[model samples]
Target: MNESALLAILLSLASAVGYALAAVGQSRLAAQGGGGMGQLLTRPLWWWAVGLNAAGALMHVAALHYGPLTLVQPLGALTLVAALPLSAYYARRRVTRREWRGAAWTLAGLTGLIAVTGPASPGDALSLSEALAIAAATALLLAFLVRAGAHSSRGTGLGHATASGIASGVASALTQTVTASLSHALPGGPLPWWGTSLVAVLVATFAVGGLLLSQAAYRGGLAAPLAVVNIANPAAAAVIGVALLGESFHGGPLGWLTAAASAAVAARGVIMLTGATPADLPTPLPTVLPTELPAPEPAVRITA
Candidate 1:
């Protein structure tokens, strides 16, 4: 492989490791139980996890700069595969047989999807109408997901996790757009008047939203919700890349069908993974004293 491809792979894998570690750390904190963001923020470990996540993002951007979206974004799915063993070891959680199968399915399906997406070609600068349309549609979808999560009997963790992934994916696509826009702009030139700064702000908003949702996803466990986010985030990003960024598939219509089928397979895997829960695993609890130590004898038998 060329140096650039090798670098991209290394960076992508490192990014995956960083994200996997962050997920495991945050999941542990969430498992400890807390009332609100304030309570969770008090822990230093939470900050460390945030730092790891940020670092991972930086690595991802670097990878993107050096590689194509089809290559870098798809590799991001490695996070889910990496999360498996990390959760098992660091979280002291069991990896059920079903969970293992789910991970395999996710890996297989994601790989196929990425392979089908093929290489992407950079396109025209994002227009205001396009940006607004995409943002509106995403917002509406997120709103619906939020409401569904609130009322769903199957648990809102998946819904929230999926929302988080979508947000992250959108943010990723916007980041690339902004980066491209900046590069195309002449040095010392004024920023474009067509809401460039507005787009940047929106990017930050989506990123923060995704971060919060990811932490919430851990409230359930590291396996299922993580898998969902893993699939959703990149899938959404890929969509933006194709629709807005002018990326294209290799085989045209046939490729689209293949990609769709692969996505379905990956979605099914996420559902299967959700079946495994922390509750299913053995946990060590503190041994209880058989009986309360008899109240210490009265200090000096003064009652007598």
Candidate 2:
């Protein structure tokens, strides 16, 4: 392999390791189960996890800069395999067989999906309409996930984890689109002046959502939930690539079959993970509510 490719691979692996450590660390904090977001903010481990997460992102960005998307993204699936044993391990929880199976299936499926993702279209920028459609779709999905999570006890973490993956995927898609638009030749001259910045804003919004949701998912075990995020992220991105980014499956009908099978396998893995790692009750934090005012308010109305 060329030096660039080799460097990208090494960086990707390092990125995977960083993400695994960060996820496991956050999982440890969530498993302790003490306080709310306020308390979570005070914990040192949380900050460490955040720092590691940032480091992982930097590594990933560097990898992407150095290598092709097809190479960099596929290697990202390594995070699933790496996080398998690290989940809640700090809490002295042993890895379960079910978690192992889930991780294997997830990794296999994600690998297959990446293999078939094919290359992005040369020099194409996402149209404004396409970006809007993606935004609308993700918004609806997030709303549904949040509402669904609210009613079901077990589904809460799963829902948030799923939302995290989708948000991250969408954010990535937008990021790639905006970045490509700036550097590459656009078919229609250029994207509008505000278009790139608007997409950047969207990217930030969804990236933050992804970060928070994934943290919420760690309230249970990191392995399964992290697996879910890993699977969903690439799956969602592949869909965007094919539908909106002018990428296509290779090998015609066979490629489509492979894609479908990979998706099903990934979905099954997610299902298994949700059942395997049941969510612990989240620590309830205080919510601000209006306290009852004295009857003196009636006197003020009368005076007015």
Candidate 3:
């Protein structure tokens, strides 16, 4: 493989590892009944998760340096596939069969998305006007979600997952914007102040939004919300990339049809996961007997 391809693969792997660690940490926090933004910001474990995420973002930028945005962006979707088994194995959580099916469909849709999308050129950059428009639109959408999320009660799994998905999508979009700005403004020279400012804003937005969404997702059930967020975020990014960034697919109408079909498969996965209930799977029970249990004589006295 070429150097760029090698770099892309390495970055994808790094992103996968980073996402896994972050997911595990976030899930643990939720299980422990961590509160909203305040708890997340104060916890040392949360900071560790944030650091892992930052490292992943750094690797993602490095991958973009070598590979097409079309390629690198889609590979990030692999996080959905990676998180499922990782949660099950490391976190000792059971993944329902339905969840697995849903994950499969989601992956299929994403794979089709990647295959159908046209290749992106290295160092592709957006105009300032376009960047501002995208930023504004994303901000507006986030505001709407925040308003909607506020009314949602705690422990509402689906609501939390939906909110988390929106946050993740916005974060992904902001990251793309930052990547585009940095790539264009810093070519062969010192970085511009405006570009640096954009990067910082995007990074902070991504981190904060992602952290909240992740915590909410864990409370809602890690696998389902995770599956939804992972699929939805990339799907949104792919659409934006195609429409705004001039990405296209080969094979004309047939290709579009195929892409649609792939998306359907992915949607199926998300649907399956959403329908899953914890009762459908076996729960781990306490293995050790209670030390304070009454003696056998109590049982004999109760016989009537």
Candidate 4:
């Protein structure tokens, strides 16, 4: 394989691992019955998960350096594929047949996407107006999520998951934008003042938003929200790349439409896996307290 392809594969694997670890950590947190942001940050395991995610993001950037946006962007969906088995292993939870079928569907769609997308060069520089627009849009979406999350009930896990997915997707998009802008600035010797400033703001925004969303998603169900975000993020980026960056597919418009349809199918699969009804999830085992087991003492006396 070529260097770009190798990088893409490696980065995709790294991202999958990172997301899996993050999912595990999140599941542990929820299992612990921890609530609120304060409780979350205190856990050492959560920190480790965050670090893993950061490492994954770094690998993703590296992949972008070597591969086309079209190829690199879609490969992120691999995280969704990886999360299921990893969660099962770590939590000792079994995935239902529905989940496996859903994952398969998602994988098939993403595979079609990768096959159809055409390679293209990234833009040399993002115009000032474009940077500002992206920043504004990201901010607006985040603000909306925060407002919505505030009103949502704690037990409504799916709501939290959806919000987190949206936040993570927006953050991922901003991160890509920053990466592209920085790359453009680097080739010109000294980075332009405006470009540097814009990139810095966007990077910070992306990182912070991504962190919060990830934490919330972890609080929800790691598998569901992570799956949702993984699918949504790449889909959004791919759309931007095609619409704004002039990227296209192999066999023209018909091929592009077919790839999109496949992606939708894949997305439906992911939703099916993670969007289990109450009956699907394991029920909490009832606790037996010492007081509740007092009958054991009487039995011992009778034996004596």
Candidate 5:
């Protein structure tokens, strides 16, 4: 990989860690039940979560500046691995064998994805009309998901978590477009004020909206919902990148097969961890991920 690709990978990792930490904090807040909106705003943890999320997003934009969406998107799944120890530390949760195994699978799949991808160079950005169309569609989808999530309280928050992932994924794609376009304008390219303003509104809307939805999804607990969110976010971004942004897979058929297989492995790991909570914690975690994570041999016991 070139320097740009390497830097993108590093930035993506930093962003993932930030997001993972933030999600843990948010999950803790959810565990406490509704703190009332005002009370929540007054809490230090809430601010930390919000601040970390914003920091992650800014870095994500930078990573997208140098990397292809496919490469950067998959790397975000590492957040789960990173979140494990944090979850344990904060919630006094034990790392179950199932959790470890799932984390291992997620790590393995992401590694394969990286190996298959090549260096990324800056690519085409979406035009105003195209972005607007995407924005409209995203808005409608999010509306439906939010309603589904609100009703999912007694059950798994899978629907809510999925919505967060989609919102976040779309925001990431638009961030790339806006970043490229604005950079182009900086070099004397024509800047359309209307386009700039419109996309900005949409980006802000989705970014903040995704964060809020993720907070709601955490009402149950953290594991399953986090996994779903991470997988969905990357999948959404990869689709938009390939279908609309003219991005393509780096390797040929063999590489594609590897990526597909790796993804399946990761998904399986997610399932293994779906309902496993700490023995000490009584409440179930909400299901899907914010930037989420791991690796290793058999240092820890593997349980069914």
Candidate 6:
């Protein structure tokens, strides 16, 4: 790899660590819960989480400035690995043997995935029409996931978290796209208005939407919902990287099979990790209901 790619990989890894810390902070806030977004403004921990996320985003943007989206997106998955020990330390959660195994599996698979993929090259900026189409598609999918999350009982939390992840993934792609456009803009010249406007709208929508949904994801529990988010986020970003950004993998049919197997192994690891819970973290009460009431004592039957 070239120096630029190497730098991007390092920066992306750093960003993953930041994101992991931010997730842990947010999960803690969720566990202790008592506020909406407005209310969270009064809390220091919320600010800490926000700051970490912002820092991470900045680093990610910088990484994308120098690296291919495909490379950077997959590297972000390292956040899960970073989060394990951090969660134990900051969240006061114990890392179980199962979680360690999950982490190992994820790490091994990601290593293989990276090895099989070819080095990344710089990408082209999307045309306005292309950007809009991508934004629309992402929005539609996000809508579907939100609807499913609202009604589904089996994996409601996972659905919302996955939606959040998808939104975040789109936001990341947009961020990289915007950055590329801006970089190519004439230095000391006025910015291009039309392209800028579309990017601004799309980026803001997905970023804010992702943040809100992520907060909600924490209500279910840290491990399960977080696993879903971590898994979905990169997968979505990789799709955009491959489809819109002109990135690709090589090594023919054998390589494709290897990549698929690697992804499956990583996904399986996330599942295992989700099953391993941190001891003593209380699940949040349902938002749809008021505080739980005493089970109404069996109403004495009135004489017929």
Q: TM-scores of all models?
A: 0.84, 0.83, 0.74, 0.76, 0.77, 0.76
| Over 4 Å off, model 6 | 1-13, 62-75, 91-93, 111-123, 151-154, 185-192, 278-304
lDDT of 6 by residue, 126-229 (tens): 55666789899988888888788777532666778989989987887776567667776422332477877779788998988887788777766666677677
List ranges where model 5 is wrong by over 4 Å: 1-14, 35-38, 59-76, 110-123, 149-151, 154-156, 185-191, 278-304
- What is the C-alpha local distance difference test score of candidate 2? 0.81
Give candidate 5's whole-model lDDT: 0.76
lDDT of 2 by residue, 1-304 (tens): 9999999999999999999888888777877887887997899998998899889999999998899978998788888778766654554566677767877787778888888878666665567778878988999998899788867655777788889999998997887678777875666656777987888888999998898888887775666678778877877887888877777888889999998999899878877776676543235688977699656544445553
**Candidate 2 RMSD computed on C-alpha atoms after optimal superposition onto the true structure:** 11.3
Clashing pairs in 6: none
Give the residue spans of candidate 3 off by over 4 A: 1-7, 66-75, 91-94, 122-124, 146-203, 281-304
Clashes of 1: 0
TM-score of 2: 0.83
1-304, model 1: which lDDT tens digit per residue?
8889889989999999999999989888878885798887788888989999999999998997788767887788888878888888875666778888888888778887878765444444455556667778888998788788876523678888899999988886666556666776423332485667877887898998898888887787888888888878868867876876677666999888888888888887887887766446787787975775667765665574
lDDT of 1: 0.79
Using TM-score as the measure, the top candidate is: 1
In model 1, where is the ten-residue run with the lowest total lDDT?
Answer: 185-194
* Model 3, CA-based lDDT: 0.68
Clash number for each model: 0, 0, 2, 1, 18, 0
**Winner of 1 and 2 under TM-score:** 1
Q: What is the C-alpha RMSD of each candidate to the true structure, in Å?
A: 5.5, 11.3, 5.6, 5.5, 13.3, 7.1
Write one digit per residue (lDDT tens) for candidate 5, span 191-273: 48777777888888888888888888778667767876777676677677677766666677887898799789867866666
**Residues 108-200, model 3: lDDT tens digits:** 787787777765454544444555676677667655665665664433554555555655655565555566555564234434668657655
| Candidate 1 TM-score over all chains jointly | 0.84
Candidate 4: residue 251 lDDT (0-100): 91
Say which prediction, candidate 2 or candidate 6, comes out ahead on TM-score: 2
